[model samples]
Target: MDQTTLNYIVVGLSFALYFGIAIWARAGSTGEFYAAGRGVHPVLNGMATGADWMSAASFISMAGLIAFTGYDNSTFLMGWTGGYVLLAMLLAPYLRKFGKYTVPEFIGDRFYSTAARVVAVICLIVISVTYVIGQMTGVGVTFARFLEVDVTTGLLIGSAVVFVYAVLGGMKGITYTQVAQYCVLITAYTIPAIFISIALTGNAIPPLGLFGDHTESGLPLLTKLDQVVTDLGFASYTGHHSNTFNMFLFTMSLMIGTAGLPHVIIRFFTVPKVADARWSAGWALVFIALLYLTAPAVGAMARLNIMDTIQTGEVGSPEGNLLYAERPQWIKNWEETGLLSFEDKNGDGRIQFYNDKNADFASKAEEFGWAGNELTVNRDILVLANPEIAQLPGWVIALVAAGGLAAALSTAAGLLLAISSAISHDLVKSVFNPEISEKGELMTARIAMTGAILLATYLGLNPPGFAAQTVALAFGLAAASIFPALMMGIFSKRINSKGAIAGMLVGLVLTVGYVFTYLGMFFIPGTNILPNTPDNWLFGISPASFGTVGAVFNFLAAYVVSMQTEEPPQEIQDLVESVRVPRGAGGATGH
Candidate 1:
């Protein structure tokens, strides 16, 4: 079968599977819709959290990032997974014990202030919406490439599908959809990796193969990649190329960001008990590790493949780097979407793929009759194009597209659910309709969800630059704002309204200002007010890693201010003690 036909069949099967699951696990009440009725098994919740946590970025973009950038990009790998360890150890079980339907609800009751919850609601919306846009963009990219549709159309289709399940079934719908998504995305990720590892190393496991001898070359795969890339004037793939300090900070930032994210936290709220939350986190990490462990291998192998394609006699003229005519079928397919572009800058029919910034290679390339670097590969295409790169079957390629969409759409739906519930459950129902009927409030929640989706869809289509990047700001906002508030609410009984508000505002401002000014996204030609470089950063922290620092500031500020002011009220203090212990409450807390 042709790739496009296979794509349709695979995508069709996935759609049917998700829609069917939505039907089978359709939520009837607001409780079921928002928190899966707080009756979910820890194992099942872990799987759902895995899917919810690994969005398009993790499935599609991350390995490619590590593939091209080498070990310096390992921060992404460590940041994302390491944070889960922190979440499991520090936050998940305690919060699950707190039993909130939404994060803001916990903040509201814990701090004995509506303002605290409102601030949390804003931060949650910011984090989830930004996160959702990236997922939406990933879905569109996958659709445009595999499903053969314009991205605008793809986004619309993606949105419509998510709307149906998410709006209808709520958290119940998203949780089950995520389970299927995790399976599809993980299978798609690992199968090609296993094939590539077997082909190259005679070892079945990619991670082991990564360190094992390459069968053809008789060298460790990393060593081979490092040698070959450096021979072509590119930095050694296995060596440290990026600034070590910045990379360390960036990795730490990702970890803290991961722990701070609200949507991931809410997943724990659905578990049956405190112990279930603890075990659930362990299971989620286990599932996540399946990909996290394999990602480095994929990176190394893909880098090796790319270098081998570009160097010494693959495609270009007898003297030139790979010729334009010799482009792979996968490259041709990706080129159709304008993601992989080749301009033949030298007017030679051959395409030069190299590190243009390598000053030492300039004179050598000129002598070799090469023009300039011609091949441009988008990082997001790495995973999507991996099956094709490995000469996998048409079904495998098609399956990858479905898997990418599933990962993107499922996470997007989870974020949307969180956003909608924050607005409806926290704001509308909690504050406005303290006396409203359960059915009436559920109706309001559905309406809120629909409106939230529409808004997100529009924002996603033209997202702000600051808003779109994953791991850093999205997680930063959560950490600097929501995570801090939730922590204060739970651990610090003395955190009064004044302290909570000031701490959140301070954390939010410092983190946002640093990200915006240094990232140069908030304004055109930003002030260079603060250098993003590690040496120049506050306390030698990478701007990417600054959220953890900001979170610490929040903790300190709240603690100091609380000591200087009043304590949490007697009733709220009792509520804190009740939440601290894992006594009763099989249900998630709410208005």
Candidate 2:
């Protein structure tokens, strides 16, 4: 069968499976809808968490970032992985022990303030909505290429699919659906990595192959990659070229953000017991490691393959460039999606893929009669196109299409759940209508999810950055606003309602203000106060790294405000102590 047909069948079947799971596991009550009735097995919850946690950012964009920027982008890997560890170790069990349906519920009860809960809901909505934009972008990218549709249509289709399963199943349906998605995405990701690894390094394990000698050059894989990219005036694959302070801050932001993310933290609420939550976190790490470990290898190998394709011979040789007329079928297929294109800047009828911005390469490019960089390849396409670039079988390519969709859809469902629950459970039921019926609450949750998906789809069409960068911004927001509040609520007895509210507002406003100043107000085009360049950043901190700084301000503001005011009530202090200790190991209670 043709590749396009195969892609349709594979992606269609995956959608069928997700819809089937949602139907089978349809939530029957508010408890089931919000927390899956707290019955998920630890291992199963871990698998589901893995699918939820490894969104388009991890599956579709991290490696692409690594491939293009080299080691400077490794912060994505370190930050995300380390952040999961921080979440699992420091937050999951305690939050689960507290026995809340949502993060806002926990914050509200812990702080003994309705205002605190409302603020948390706002933060959750903002963080989740921003994060969902990235997932929707991935969805649009995958569908545009595989389904041969425009990005807007693709996003609408993907949104429809998510709406059916997520709104119907709620967390109950999404948890089980995510487990199936985890299977599909992991298989799709690793199979291509293993194939490419063996092809390039003659090793079966991708991570091992990354350090092994390249089959073609007999040099270490990274060493060969460095030589190839440097020959084209790009930075070395293994070199660190970013500011150390920024890298540290970025990593810390991701770590705290992981712990703070409402979708991920809520996953712990699905398991039956505190012990189960811990086990779920551990198992999740294992499942996440499978993909994280393979990502660097995939990035390095994909980069080398791209360079090899463009520079078919020695770099700087006029005859070395690949002829545009003879470009591979993969390039043509991607071009149809508008994510990859070639322009003959020099009218040389050949493609030039190099660092044209490198001034040192200018004279040499003039010597070679090259005008400028002629290939425009979006980083998000690298993984989806990797198998095709390597001439893998039609089925493998189709599987990758399915995997990318699964990764995006799974996380989208999770985030939508967080958004909906924050609205229905935290906002309407808790604040507006204190006596909302269970059925009314469930319907409200589904409606909230639908609205959230619509908003996400609309914003995704005009994303401020690539999938991963947008996600990184979401992480920074969460880190600044949510993580500090949760940490202090659990660890400190003196933090009062006023303190929590003050800290969250400060963190949220500062981070959002800084991000908007550069990324555009509300991420709308032409609204930015300054250019989003390195030189324009504050204290050399990129917007993506400013979350840690925001988090620090959150901590300071809370501490200062709390000491100047009254301490939390005695019962609130006891609640904090109980949440931290394991004496009363009981089942989670619903609000």
Candidate 3:
């Protein structure tokens, strides 16, 4: 059978399972819809959180980024994983003890200000909406590549699937569906890595295989990879080439942003108690690390594999390179998607995949009669094509298609829930219609989900950035606007409502302004005031890294404003103290 047919079968079966689970576990009440009735077990919640947290960026694009950028991109792995430790220790327990349905609800109540809640709802909507664009785009691209449909058709199909589950079951349906998604994605990710590892290094374990000896070269896997890439005029595989200051700040931004994201923070509210929230954070990290640890290894191995395939033998010899006519089926397939291209700049009929701008390597290429590099491989193709590159079985390739969809769908559902809850619970019911009935709220939440899905689908067709880059922006906004407010609410008793509100607005405006100056105004075409490059950046910090500066501004602004404003009410002070202690904490009741 053809590989595409197998992919359709595997992906179809997985979607069937997800849709079935959503139907079986359909939500019945506002409480269940919003917080799963606050009855989820810690481990199961952790698994669900894992699936929710690892979006298309983590599953589909991260390793590819790492593959192309080398050690400089290690920020993604370290920042994303390290933030969980901070989340577990600083944020999760207290938030669970307070027992709120949404992140904005906690912010509003803690500050005792309706205006503060409204600001938070706006921030939550912006961040979640930005994050969902990447997921919806991933769904479109994955279906387009595997299911052989146009991107618009794939997006409609993916959105329909998410709507059936998320709108029907709410958080209750999403949680169980996410558990199954976690299983599918992890299995799909690991099996290919294991096969590739064994193929390259005679080791089944991917992490260990990354450091193990390469079976063909009698050298360590990384050592062989470094040598191969350097020979092709690229930087060494393990070397750091970015400005140190920018790298550090970018890593810190992603870490802070990871902890602050409303979708992730809301996961803690689903668990039964404060203790479960704490334990659940740790378990979520454990599950996340399973893929995280394997990603770098896959990146290193896949890079080596691609270089080896093209070079064939010596880099500067006539008999060494793979001719264009001899390109593999995987190369041909990806070329059809317009993501992989070869120009043959030297017109030698044989592909030359290298960094042509290396002045030091120019003489060597001239001797080999090569003009410039010819092959252009999109980073997102590495993982999806890895199994084929390694000549793995057809089933493994099918599993990869299903896995990417699972990761994207699970995260989209979680973000939509956060958006819908913010609209219904925090904005509409709290402020506009306090007398709204439970049934009415439920109907509104589903309606909100449907609207959010439509918006996300339209935006997905024209994403502001690639999968991972767009996600990083979402994290930056979350860090600047939401995280500082939450930490101050729990840790400081003097942060007044006015101070909190001012800080969030300042952070949100500054971070977004800096981002739009380079990424285009509201991400529309022909609207950017400046080019997005390191030389033009302030102190060489990318817009994505500006979140760190924005967050610092939030902290200082809030503190300065609090000093000039009236202190919070004594009763609000006592509520802060009550949430800090874990004793006497019961199941979260209504707001």
Candidate 4:
């Protein structure tokens, strides 16, 4: 069969499996819809959570980020993964035991304030909407490339598939589908890494192979990579060159942000018990580490591979040249989708694939008769294109398409689930329409999912930033706004409604304003303001890594406001005490 046909069969079958699961495991009620009726097996929930957590961003963008940026991008790896540890330890079980439908529910009920709930709702919507768009963008990109459709058509199709399963199965359907997605995505991700690892480093294990000896250089893979990239203008693969302060802060931000996200926190709610929540988090990490460990390895090796492909031959040999006409099929395929593009910026006949501005190395390459650098590969293509680059079989390539779709869809569904529940259960049912019937509530939730998906689709068509950037925005907002309130509600009893709301608004405004100044989301063009480089940063904090500062502001604001105000009522303090202890937490009732 042709490659495109095979891709279609594999992708179509995978979606069919997801839709089938949605049908078979359809939720019977609002309880099942929102929390899978709190009955998911811990192991399965762990897998689902893994799939949910590792979205299209992790599957598609992370390795590529690590690949091109060298060691500095480790913030993404550290921040994304470290967040889960925070979730497992600081938040997950307690939130799960609190027995709420959404994060806002926990905040409002624990703090005993409708206003607090409204503030939580606004934060949830902001974070969840931004996150959902990223997922939708991923889904569209996967389909546009593999399903051979336009981005718009692909997005509609992808949105429709998620709607089917999400609306039908709700949490129950999504949880199981996510387990399947985890299987598909992990297999798809690792196959290429394993193949390329053996091909480049002669080691079977990709992770160890990263540090293992390279057959060509007889040195560690990272050692060879650092040498090659530096021979060009790139930073060392295993060395650090960015601001340590910002790196540390960025990592902290992603950790708190991850713990704060509504979709991820709600997953813990489905596990059977508090102790199970703890272990389930460990299992989720294990599953997540499968990709996390492999990702950097993939990034380093893929960077090395591209360099080797262009630089492998004798300096003047035609074989040494990266020719536009002689490019690989994967290059052509991705180019067709506009994900992998090169301008031949110098317009030389040959594709110059090197860091030309490496003042020291530029002179040597010029003496060697090379032209200016030309290639500009999109980082998002790294994970998705890895299999094809490694010469993995057709099945493996197909599996990647399936996996990318799985990752994107599962995450989109999860975010939509979070958005819908916050609206239907927390906002509408809990605060606004307290007299609504259970069936009416469920329908409202489904409708809200539909609305959220549509908005996400529109925004996804032209994503405000890269997948990771969008996710970071979601995390940043969650960190600045929701996380502080949730954590204080659990850990402190003095914070009143006024304090929480005011603190959240301040955090939200500061973070959003800073982000907009750099992102150009609010007014003037982002680049016109500053370069976002070390030389231009405020207090050496990169904009990409400034959420930690935003979060600290939140903490300070909440505390200051709380101390100046009346103490929370005795009943609210008692409620806070009840949530902190372990005995009746798993069995607590109502949002």
Candidate 5:
């Protein structure tokens, strides 16, 4: 069969499989809907967490970002992965032991203030909504590429799939669905990397292949990559060009944001015990590391491959570079989306893909009868087009389509669940209708979920950035508003409800403001006060790194406010002490 028919066949099968799993695992009660009945196995929950945690940002956009920016973007890999250590050691078991259905519930109960819970719900909603935009966008991109549909249609179809599984199955349905998704996504991710690795370095293991000698160049893979890219006037593939302090802050923001995200934390609550939560975090990391380890290799190899393709002959020669007529099929496909463009700057009919910013390179380009760089590639296309670029089998390309969708859909479902639970369980039932029936609450949860899907889909259609960049902003907000509050609630018994609420407000307000000032005026078009550039950053901290600063402000504000206020009630203090140990951990029984 041709690629399009094969793509439909493979992608159709995956969707059918997911819908079937959702139907088989439909949730029956609020408990099942919220936390999977608290009976999930540790290993299974771990796999589910891996799927939940690795969104489109991780699977689709990350390696591509690294491919274009080189080592400067390693912050993404380290920040996202390192936060799991914090989750495993500091947050997951304690939250699991607290036996709550939603993150705000823990905050409200721990602080003994309904106001604290309400603030948490707002923060959760904000973080989750922003995060889901990326997933929605990813789904749209995947559909537009493989299914040849428009982004709006792709988003609607994706939202329908998520609504079917997430609304019907709740956490129960999502957990098992995510487990199957993890398998599909990871397989899709690794198979392409393995093929590319062997093709580049004669090594099957991607990480080893990243460092291994290139079969053709007889130099280390990275060494060859650095040489090729720099030869094309780009920075060395291994060099770090971003500001040092900003990189550190950016990395810290991602770490804190990862540890603080409500969706990942809720996965631990589904497991049977506190011990299970801990082990599940480890297992989740093991699964996550599989992709993390291979990503650098994929990025590096893809960059090298792309460069080699464009620069087929010696630079500065009349015959240098691939002619426009000789452009590959992958380029043609992406060009239709406006993601890849060619300008033919010199009207030479040949494409010059190079760094025009390098003065030395510009002078040489003049000598070579070249005007400037002519090809523009979107960073996201690196991973998406990798299989096609390498001329891998039609099935492999189709699998990438499925994998990208699976990653986006799984995480979108998880975020929507978090948002719906916050509204229905935490806001509607817990505070507004304390006497609401379990059945009424479950129905409300499903409704809230449907509403959230509509809102997120709308936002996804007009996302502020690429899949990963949009998600990173959400992380910054999470790090600022949620993570610090949870840490103080557990580690500092002296922090009062007043202090916690104050911290979240300050963090949320300031972080959102900072992000908006650069992103746009509340993300409106052409409304930003300042351009989103490094020169306009605060103390050299980019908006992506501003989360760390917000977190620090949260810590200080909470501490300072607590010093001037009354302490938490003695009973609340004891509740804090109880969760610190794993002895009394049991299945979560109540909302």
Candidate 6:
């Protein structure tokens, strides 16, 4: 069968499986819809969490960032992985023990104020909606290429599929469906890595292959990559080029953001016991490691392949560049999607893929009669196109298409559920309509999810940045606003409702104001107050790294507000103390 037909069949089968799971595990009650009735096995919950945690940022854009920027982007790997550790170690078990359906519920009860809960709901909505935009972008990119549709139509189709399953299954449906998605995505991710690893380094393990010698050049894989990129006037593949302080802040933001993310924290609420939450976190780390370890190798190998294809001979030679007419099939397929393009800037028929912004490189390029960089490849397309660029089988390419969609859809479902629960359970039911029936809340949850998906889809069409960069902004927002509130709610009994609310407002306003000044208000283009450059950043801190600074302000504001007000009531303090203790530890073994 043709590759296009294979893609349709594979993606169709995956969608059918998701729909089947959603139908079978459809939620029946508010408890089931919000927390899967708290019956998920630790191992199973772990697998589901893995799927939920590894969104389009992890699967699609992460390696692409690593491929283009090399070691400077390692913050993505460290921050995300380390952030899960922070979640598992610091937040999951305690939050699960608090026995709340949602993060806002925990915050409201702990702070003893509806206002705290409402603020949390707002934070959840903002963080989740921002996060969902990245997933929708990934979905649109995948569908546009594989389904041969425009990005807008592809996003609508993907949105409809998500609405059917996510709105139907809620947490129960999403949890089980995510397990199946984990299987599909991991298989899709690793198979290509293994294939490319063996092809390039003659090694079967991709992570090890990254450090192993390249079979073609007899040099270490990273060493050869450094050589190839430097020859094209790009930074060395393994060099660190970003500001150290900014990298520290960015990584810390991701770590705290991971712990604060409502969708991920709510996954812990699905397991039956508090101990099960910790166990699930452990299992999730194992599953997540499978992909995280493979990502660097995939990035390096894909970069090497692109360089080799473009510079078939010596870098500066007249015959080095690939002819536009004879470009590879993978390039042609991607070009059709409009994500990858080549322009003959110097009227040369050959494609030049070099850094034209480097003044030193411009002199060398002029010697070769090259006008400017001719190829424009979107960073998000590297992984999806990797198998094709390597000439993998039709089935492998189709599988990757399925995997990308699975990664995007799984996390989108989780985020939408978080948003849905916050609106129906936290806002409408808790604050506005306390007498809301269970059935009414469930319907509201579904409706909220539909609205959230629509908003996400609309914003995704005009994303402010690449998928991973967009995700990073979401992380920064969560880090600044939610992380401080959750951490203080659990660890400090002196923090009152007023303090919690004050902290969230301070963090949210500061981070959002900083980001809007550069990225545009609500990320609408042409609305930015300043150019988003290092020179324009405050104290050399980029918008993506400003979350840590915001968190510090949150901490200080909460502390100051609490000192001026009364401490939390005695019972609320005791409740905080009780959650810290492991009440159901012994019972977890019996299960």
Cα lDDT of model 2 by residue, 470-534, tens digit: 99999999999999999998889899999999999999999999999988987876899999888
Writing each residue's lDDT as its tens digit, candidate 6 over 104-167 gives: 9999999999999999999998999899999999998999898788999989988988988899
lDDT (Cα atoms) of all candidates against the true structure: 0.80, 0.93, 0.91, 0.84, 0.91, 0.93
Cα misplacement distance, residue 88 of candidate 4 (Å): 1.0
Better of 5 and 6 by TM-score: 6
Clashing pairs in 4: 83-255
Q: List clash counts for every candidate, in order.
A: 4, 1, 0, 1, 0, 0
Clashes of 4: 1
> For residues 1-591, could you state the per-residue lDDT of candidate 5 as single tens digits?
989899999988999999999999999999999999999999999999999988999999999999988899998999999999999999998898888888999999999999999999999999999999989988988888888888899999999999999999999999999999999999999999999999999999999999999999899988988888888889888997879999999899999999999988999889877778888999999999999998999999999899989988887777878988988998899888777899977888999998999998888778888788899887776788999998999999999999999999999999999999999999999899999999999999999999999999999888887889989999999999999999999988999999999999999999999988888864766888898888898888888889999999999999999999998889988888888754444443222
How well does candidate 3 match the true structure in TM-score terms?
Answer: 0.98
- Which regions of candidate 3 are displaced past 4 Å? 586-591
Better of 1 and 5 by TM-score: 5
Clashing residue pairs found in predicted model 5: none
How does candidate 4 score on lDDT? Answer: 0.84
lDDT of 3 by residue, 1-591 (tens): 999899999999999998999999899999999998888899999999999999999998899999987898989999999888888899988898887899999999999999999999999998999999989878876887778788789899999999999999999999999999999999999999999999999999999999899999999988999999999889988998989998888888888888898888888888877778988998999999999999999999999999988999877889789999999988888887766899988888999998998999999999899988899887776888899888899999999999999999999999999999999999999999999999999999999999999999999988776688889889889889999999999989999999999999999999999999988877886898888889899899898898889999999999999999999999999999888865554554212
- For all predicted structures, in order, the TM-scores are 0.93, 0.99, 0.98, 0.95, 0.98, 0.99
